[model samples]
Target chain A: MSQHSIAIIGVGKIAVDQHLPVIAKNPAFRLAALVSQRGIEQAGVPTFRTPAELYAAMPDLDAVAICTPPSVRHQVALEALNAGMNVLLEKPPAPTVSELADLVRQAAARRCVLFATWHSQYNAGVEEAKKRLAGRKIASLAITWKEDVRRWHPGQEWIWQPGGFGVFDPGINALSILTEIAPEPFFVTAATLTYPANRDTPIAARLTFASDAGLPGAALTAEFDWRQTGDQTWTIEIVVEDGTRLTLIDGGSKLAINGNLTVAEPMAEYEGIYARFAGLLDRGESAVDAAPFHLVADAMVVGKRETTDAFEW
Target chain B: MSQHSIAIIGVGKIAVDQHLPVIAKNPAFRLAALVSQRGIEQAGVPTFRTPAELYAAMPDLDAVAICTPPSVRHQVALEALNAGMNVLLEKPPAPTVSELADLVRQAAARRCVLFATWHSQYNAGVEEAKKRLAGRKIASLAITWKEDVRRWHPGQEWIWQPGGFGVFDPGINALSILTEIAPEPFFVTAATLTYPANRDTPIAARLTFASDAGLPGAALTAEFDWRQTGDQTWTIEIVVEDGTRLTLIDGGSKLAINGNLTVAEPMAEYEGIYARFAGLLDRGESAVDAAPFHLVADAMVVGKRETTDAFEW
Candidate 1:
C-alpha cells in the first residue's frame, strides 16, 4: 500500500501534457526522477540525461514510465527492466512485435510488471461499450479514423521515417479500441496502404477484417488517413445481428446507441493507464496485449502498396 | 487406419513437384481430386476448376492440401475448413499472422486438423540438430540463405507482388528451421529490407535477434537474399559457449558438428510434411506454428526500407 516511486523517461510532449499531470493526481505513485536528453528540468524532482544515469543515481526506483517514440522505447525499457524496475510503455509499444515480446519475457524473468499501455483502450466509454456488446452477435463493424497530420503532428520528422508507423501511429489508437471492444477477435483479410511518394511509411490505409468462424453477414473495415483538413473524425460503429447499432465517437470518449447519447465524459486515458499499471504492479502480473500490434503488423504484411502525391509539412 | 480422401488445390509447381509424389508414397492419404485453373489433369482423378466445385461434387472429401499463392490461400483454406474438411496449408501459411491465427481458430472450432506445414522444419537433419543443441549454451548463431530467384522461380510474377513475401518465401524456410531448433525463443531487434525499385516486397533482408533473458554473449543474425546466381547456399551455423560449432547445410538436409559431418541425407521435406499431417489427423490435433511467420512479420514491421535497382525476370 506504500507509494510506488516512479520515474518519467523521455520528458517529451506526451510526458508533460498527459503523464506529469496524471502522476501528480494519482495517490499510488510518487514521481521520483526525470530522464531526458533535452535537459528539461522539473521542480523538486531529480533529473538525469539518460536511463543509465537515472538508474545509477536512483537504484530504489520502483517503476519507470517510458514515453519515448516507438523506435527508442525498447532500449530504455530493456534497461529499466534489467535494473529490476517495473516498466510502463507508451502506445505502439516497440517498433516490432519481436522486441515487445522480448521485453515481456525479460519482465517475467526479472519478476517486474511490464505494462504496455494502449491509452485509447482506457477511453471512458470503451469499457462501457465492451460491456454492452459482450454477448451480442456483431453483423458488421466499421472504423473511420482520419486526422490532419499537420494539425496534430506538426513538424515531427520521425512520423515519416521508417519505424515511425506514419499514420498508423494514430491509427493504432483506433485499433487498440477496436481490439478491446470487439465481441470476438478478427483478422485482416485484405488491405491497401498508400505511401507518400517520398516516404518509407504509409500516409493512408484501408483494411478489411473477418472473424475466424466467418460469422454470417459479418464484415469489418478500418480506414485511416492523415489528410483530413477539417472536422477530424475518429469513430467506430458496430451493428449487431438484431439491427442494434452502437457507435463510439471522439476517440472513444463518447458512446451512442442507436442515435441516443449514453455516455460522454472527459478524456482520462493516461490516468486510467497509470491506475491499471499500479494495479498490475500490486498483483505482480504483466499486461502486454499484442493484438493491436499484431493487427498493425498484419496490415503491413498484407497491404498492397500504392504511391500518393508527396506530402509536405 | 482408413486412407483419408484428400484433394489437391492449386496444383502449381510445388504441388506437382512435392505434394504429388509425397502423397503417392504416403499410404495414409489418397489423392482423391485436383483443383486448378491451369487445366492440368491427372489420370483417373476427378478435376475441378475451383475448390467450391470440387467440394460440391465430392462432399465426402476428408481433407485438402492448399498449395495456392498466399494471397489467395486464405479464401480456399477457409472454404475447405468451413466444409468440415481437415486442411493442410503450404509453408508461410496464409499471407499474414492474423489469417493463420484465424484458420487455427476455425479448425479448432470445427474439430478438424489444421496443419500449417513448415516443410523445411521437416528437413532430414533438422531434428538431429535440434536434439544436439537442446541443452547447450549458444554463444552465437548465423543463418545464410541465399538463392537465385531467377533460376528457382523463373517467371513467377506473383513472387514480386504484395503478400508474395519475395525473398521471405524462401527466407521463412530458414526461419522455420531456426525456430524449430533454437534452445529458446528469440525475437528480432533490428532489420533492413531491400526492395526492388518496382516491386512491392523485399528482395533481400538482414535481421538481428536476441533472447529475452539475454543469453550470455549470444548473438543471432539472418541474411536472406535472392541474388545468389551460382553456388546457391542455405546454411545455419551456431557456436556454443564451449566453442563447439554446429552447422546445417543444404537446407538442413545435412548437419555438421565441429566441422565433422554428423548427419547427411537426401531431402524429403514434403514427405515428412505429409507424415506429420497424418499423425496430427490421427490424434485429432491441429499443428499450427506461427513463430516463423511472426518473425517475418516482425521484420517487415521494424525493418528499414531501401530501394535497389529495378528487377527484371
Candidate 2:
C-alpha cells in the first residue's frame, strides 16, 4: 500500500494527546506537517503557521486531519478539500448541521475522502453492541452521561459560549454510539435544556426520543450534565422487545448483555479511526453521518430552555 | 386522468383560507375528507375527528395534505404513510429536521409519494428570480421580513409555546424562498436570536450567512421580526457579481431586476402547490427539500440568545 502523507491542523490538546500518537502508530499514514498558531512543534516534522501556508509549502500532501475546534472545522476542512487533499473531521464535525452538510457536498464534488469520525463509535464493544441490537425493536433506552467539566475540559472557556455545545460536547459521544447501534432511526421529541445563568450554552439537558419504527410509548430518554465532581458516569442501557438487555459502559469501551460481560477491551478509538480512514482513502469513499449531529441540533430546536445557577471554573 | 382522492387534516386557518379553495378549483383531485377536532366542516365533505377515523373509513384515499401545526405534523403524516397513502406537508414541514427526515424515510419505505410543499417557492417571480441567478455568484444579499404578530397570529397561544416556532413560523417562509432561488447552498455563520422573556421561542432574529460557493466577503444577512405595526415588509434584494440586481418583493409575488419590474402576478402559491402534488403523485415521486429547515435549525444551533420584554396577546 502506498503510504498517504497527512498533516494535522490545529495542534490542540486532542491533537497532541490522541491524534499525533495514533498517526505515529498507523503505518498507512506518514505525518508530513503541522499547522498551529501557537508555534507548537515536534522533532523531525515540518510545522506551518496556517493551513494556507502548509498547502503552499507541501503541494503534494495526500490528506489533512482537521483537529480544530468545531467552530472552525468547516473552513479548515473546506480549504483542505479545495487544495485537493482528503480531510478528516473530529466529533460533531461542524458547529451547525448545515455547515457539516456543506462540507459533505464539497468533499463529494471534489472526489476526496471525507471521514467524519466519532471516536466513541470506533470501539469493539460499540460494534458488538450494534450487532446484538440489530433487527430488534428497542422497548426502552436510557443514556446517562455525567462528567466534571473542570476536570475534563480544564478551563476551556469556549464550552460556556454560544455554539460550544456545553454538556452536549460529551453527550454527543453517547448519541453517536446510539445512532450507530439503534435498529431504526430515532428523533428528539422533547428536550429541556438548562442554561447556566451567566453562560450562553446549556450546562445540562434532558431529552426524550422516539423511533420511526415506533418506540413503546416514547420510553427513550437521555440526561446530560456537566457538574459531576466525583465518579464520572458515561453509560447507555437498552432493553429490547425480547426482554434482552444490553449495556455499554464507560463510553462504549465495554459492553454487557443479559448480565454477562460480552466484550471488554482496552480502548483504541483513535487507532480505529485512522485505520478506517486508510480504508476509505484506498476505496475513494466518503462517510458522513449526519444523524448524531442532527439529534443535537434537533434538541436545540425543540428544547425548552431554563436558566439555572451560574457556572464557575 | 383519474382524479386523486385527497383529504385535509387539521382544518385550521390555513386549511380554510388556502387548501379548501385550492382543492375545490383543481380538477386533478377531489376533497375526500376533513380531520379536525374543532368539528369544522365543508358542504358535501365529510369531517372526521381524527386521522385514525379517516383512515378506517376512507381506506382507498389516494393522498392527504397535512395542514396541522408543525409540532404534530410528523405523527399525523407518519400514520398516513403507514396506511399506504401519499402525503403532502405544509411549509416548514415538521417541527424539527430529524422528524422530517424520519417521515421522508417512512414514506419512501412504503412507496408513497411525500411532497413537502413550500408555498412561497411556487410563485412565478421566485421561479424567474431563481432562473436569472443561476450560474452566477452573489455579491451581496439581504432579506428583510417584518410583520405584526398581532395581525398575523392574533391570540394563537401555541406561537408563544416551546416548539411553536414563534417568529420563525413566518421567517421560515422567507427562508424557503431563499433556499429555492439561491444559486448555491449557504449556511448560518453567526446569528442573534431574540427571545421574549415570557416565551419559549424567539420573536426576532438576525443572521449572517456564507455560501459554499464563497460569497463576496460574507455579505449575506437577514433580519426577521414580528414587531412591525404597519407597512409590513417581506423582501429580498440580491446583487450578482456582474452588478445585476434582482429583487423579490411582497413575499415573492413580484420581481424586479435592476429596477425594472419583470414579473408581477396575483399570488396563487397554494394552487401551484396542489398542481405540483398532482404531478408528483402521477410520477410516484417524493419531493422533500430539507435545505430551508436545516438552515432554521442551524440558526438555532449557532445563534446567541438575548432576552427582550415579555410578550402578551
lDDT of 1 at B285: 85
Report the C-alpha displacement of residue A59, candidate 1, in angstroms.
Answer: 8.2
Show pairs that collide, candidate 1: none
Q: What is the lDDT, from 0 to 100, of the residue A201 in candidate 1?
A: 84
**How do the residues A1-313 of candidate 2 rate in per-residue lDDT, one tens digit apiece?**
6799999999998999999999999999999999999989999998999999999999999999999888888889989999999999988799888788888888999999999999999988899988988888888899999999999999899888878888999999989998999888888988999998899889899999978543558489999999988999998988888888888999999898987888999999999999999999989999988889999999999899999998888
Q: In angstroms, how far off is A25's CA in candidate 1?
A: 3.1
List, for all models, the DockQ compared with the true complex.
0.52, 0.75
**What 10-residue stretch in candidate 1 chain B is worst by lDDT?**
B210-219
Query: CAPRI verdict on model 1?
Result: medium
The DockQ-derived docking category for candidate 2 is: medium
Per-prediction TM-score to the true structure, in the order listed? 0.82, 0.94
Instruction: Tell me the lDDT of model 2 at B7.
Output: 96
Please list all clashing residue pairs in model 2, or write none if there are none.
Answer: none
